[model samples]
Each structure stands twice: as structure tokens, then as C-alpha cells.
Target chain A: MAIFRWGMHFDPLAHLRQIQRELDRVSWPWTAGARRIGGGTYPPVNVYESDAEVVVQCEVAGVEPSDLDVSITGETLTVKGIKKPLPREEELNFIRRERGSGEFTRTVVLPNEVDAEKVEANLRDGVMTIRLPKKAAGKPTRVEIKG
Target chain B: MAQDKSVKVKTTVSAAEAAEDAFSPLVDIYEKDDGLVLVADVPGASKGDISVQVDKGVLTLAAEARFDVPGEAYSRTYLSFEPGRFFRAFALSDEIDRDRITATVSKGVLTVELPKAEAARSRKIEIKVLE
Candidate 1:
């Protein structure tokens, strides 16, 4: 939906934001099963939130650092990368294959506004962890009522 | 549950604590002309923490998932994964060279290589022509 008005620019990530909200309402691959739903969604993710920051963990086994791309755009954090396969010898015959390798784009809409300047990401043991600190306005505040 | 305990019975139990008291990690099995390879996805486990064993013609993969993050979650929003043990097993064929089997962990994925036995591998017999 587009609203033509002053200072009301068309939001491109609005649909992604809506999907993120729906994913939160129900159990995901972790609760269900770790099956590859699609080509791009191979690496499943889990999110954690605290008062200060939001930590995002992505399962990226067999993915290298050189193949990863992490960026924050407005209310969404996107991860683009490729999962590379191992080298195989000649005349190799496969009997069973369950793993997959391909390029993927995973975007998560953050619940709170984050400080992009302070965001940091690290990859280890086939898992990537990203920490995004919440902005002052995004942090929760306790309001006091006086009699 | 059937207590068949047979090798053909793919007791692929899901959810928790069926294989040696741990969650069964998903695996990919493929075969080559020489042998076979098993790839398992076990994130959050270090190289030293993961273990692979081939005993009694059965292969097993085990890893300890770690939580490096600190602080309790203020509110659970999208909690999908956690730190725990991953366990899975498979029955191997007799053609495999169990003595030469090896395993390694990289980027939290465990790869196990099982070479075929000498007698089991197919060899190209050279045809001798008598003139």
C-alpha cells in the first residue's frame, strides 16, 4: 500500500516487517523441525532481547566469513550469504544427499529501533551472532504517576 | 514403540533424548566410489567439543551446543534455538573399513569419512590378449 502525502515515503521493507511479526506469533523451524523450507532459508535463526541489546544467532555451518554479508536497513536486519560445499574427488558417486548449498537472503525485522553505529557481528563454530543496541527512544521506560 | 533393535529399523526419533540422551542432529549421507561420507549439522559446538565414533558397525555423532551470550531475556520474542547436546546414530554396512574411518569438525559441521574395505571395492580386471 502506498500513501501519497508529504513526508510519507513508501516503505519498502514494510512487508518484511509484517512477516517478522507473524513469525513471532508461532513456533518456527526450531520448534517444528530443521528442514530446509526453501533454498534461501537454510540457515535458521534465533533471537534474544535484553534491555540494552538484541542478539541474533544464525546457524551457518559450512559457511565461511568471506561469504557472509550483514547490514541493517531501518527496522530490518538482512543477512546475505552463500553456503559453500566441500571439495570432492573425481568419479564421486552419491547415494544419499540431504545437505544443501546456495545463496540466501535472510531478513529479520527488529522490534525496537537499534543504534546502527554500535551494531557488531561475529561468526564462530558455524554460528553468527549479531548484537544491536537499542536506541534511547526504543528502550523501555517506567512511567511514575504521582497522586 | 517397537523394541526391534535391528539395524534396518531407522529409529529416527525426533524432539529430545532418544539417542544417548541428546537431540538428534540432522545429517547428510553421501557415497563415493571409494567409500562414504556423513555430514552433520551441529551448531554452537567447538571443534574439541564434538565427537564422532564408529563402533560395532554403527556410527554416532555427538556435540554440545554452547550459549556464549549473557543476560536473561527481558521478554521472549523469537526464541527458536537453545544450547543443548546433539546426538544421532546410523548403522554402517560391512563393506566399510571401520579401522580407517576418520572425522573432523569445521564451522560447527562434523564430517566423517568411511573408506570401503579392500575386498569390497570393485577393481577393474585387466584383460590379457593372447596373440
Candidate 2:
């Protein structure tokens, strides 16, 4: 039996099936179950505030500084890079692949606005540090009250 | 969290033999502001134990993965990435000052800074005014 409920609108079931098909095509990382597969899993990152700057450090082993791309807008910072995989033998068999590799992107939300124009990024010894100067409104200001 | 256990995994090579080919030695050349900075991933290595040797314009770096952290003997499995030996080598050109090379290691990562030679470095020259 042909089921047609709406007169002209698209079928609800068909739309849902199409959405599911689209979702399956997306590459989702392994969060809780199954083994994750990839070439570049982003390294651990740490962000903290100093006297005049917010410093962000990221551990990017096996990656060169030239390959990193950093961009900031408003109060958001994004670090993207690619970690090329080591050349492997054609017939080498692997039992488990724990290290995720390929291209990785890590986005961080800052607590306050930053001076995107004066931002500086330095990478040394597998660690990339980004120094962001806080904006005037983002810094702590002293308020005086007259009685 | 998984428990910390150190188990002796099966490797085709023995301990003494494995120590020889512990880490792969190769240098990655890169360009920086002043000169070139080479970053080598030498896991399980500590400061004051690694050496960067440059002889006849060829740079050879050596470092080992020596760990003292004790682990409980349990059902432990190891893979090829379980911190063994670290090694890397690179070639330098006339652009770099062979005597000015500096190396520092922190958190198992080695960074070698090769400043450009005086003649090779870019400098601003002042023009003399004519009478």
C-alpha cells in the first residue's frame, strides 16, 4: 500500500531517512566505544592567564611549527595543523593503532576579548605557545566611589 | 582509569640488541625568523644526556629513552611506541654558523637552534649621503 499523508509536503519518513544517510557519511571520532582511526589526533592543550597576557600551550609531537595554522576572532581561537604519518612498510601488520593521526583542529573559547592584531604564536620543542593580550574592556579595572 | 603496569612485551630483538637500533635518527629542516630551528622528538630522554654532533657539515644527534619510573608487574602489553630510543640526524649548509648552534631539551622534546652566519643573515645597510 502506498502511504501518502500530506497533500504536497515532503514525506516525513523520507526526510528522516535522507538525514540519516547524510549523517552516516560524516567522519565521527571515537568518543566512547570502538577504536579510533585517523592520522592526526590533536595534542593536549593548556590555557592560562598571566599578568598581562593569556598564554595557551599545546603539545604537538611529531609536528613541525611551519605546518601549524592559528586564527583568532572575538573571543575564540582555533589551532589547526596536520601531522604527517611516519612512512611504514607495505607488509607490516599492526595489532592495535592507538595513536590517532592526520589533520587535527582544536578550537578554544577565551574567557574575555583579546587583541587579535597583536597576537603572537611560537612553536619550540613540540610545544606551541600562543600569547594573546587582553583588550581594555577585558582587563580588570578599579572603580572609585565618591561618598 | 587504566592501571599502570610494566610488562615485558615480546620483541624479536633482545634488550642489548634493541638498544642499538632504539630510536630512528633523522633531522627535519625548517625555516624560522632568524635562521632554522630543528625539533626532534626524543621521548624518554632527559636533559644533559643528549648530544648534537656536527662534523664536516653533517649534523648527527643522539638520545636514548632511559626511564626510571617504576611500574607494577601486571598484565601489560606494549607496542612499537612504548618509548624506547630516540635518534635523528640532519645536514647543515653554509647559511648556518656551525659554532653558534644551540640545543635544549624539555619534556622529552629536543630543540636545536641554528642561527644564520653573519654574512648569510639579512641586514639593513645605511646609504651614505653625497655632498
Q: How high is the CA lDDT of each candidate model?
A: 0.71, 0.57
Best by lDDT: 1
Clash pairs detected, candidate 2: A38-A101, A39-A101, A39-A102, A40-A101, A40-A102, B25-B87, B25-B88, B26-B88, B26-B89, B27-B89
Docking class of 1: acceptable
lDDT of 1 by residue, B37-124 (tens): 8887778887667666666677767678885754665444554466778876678899998778777777777877889999999899
Residues A1-147 of candidate 2 have per-residue lDDT tens digits of 112211133445878866664565454421211222123335555556644567666666667677799999667888989876534523334322333357888777765578999999876435566878878664577799999
- Chain B TM-scores per candidate, in order, are 0.76, 0.67
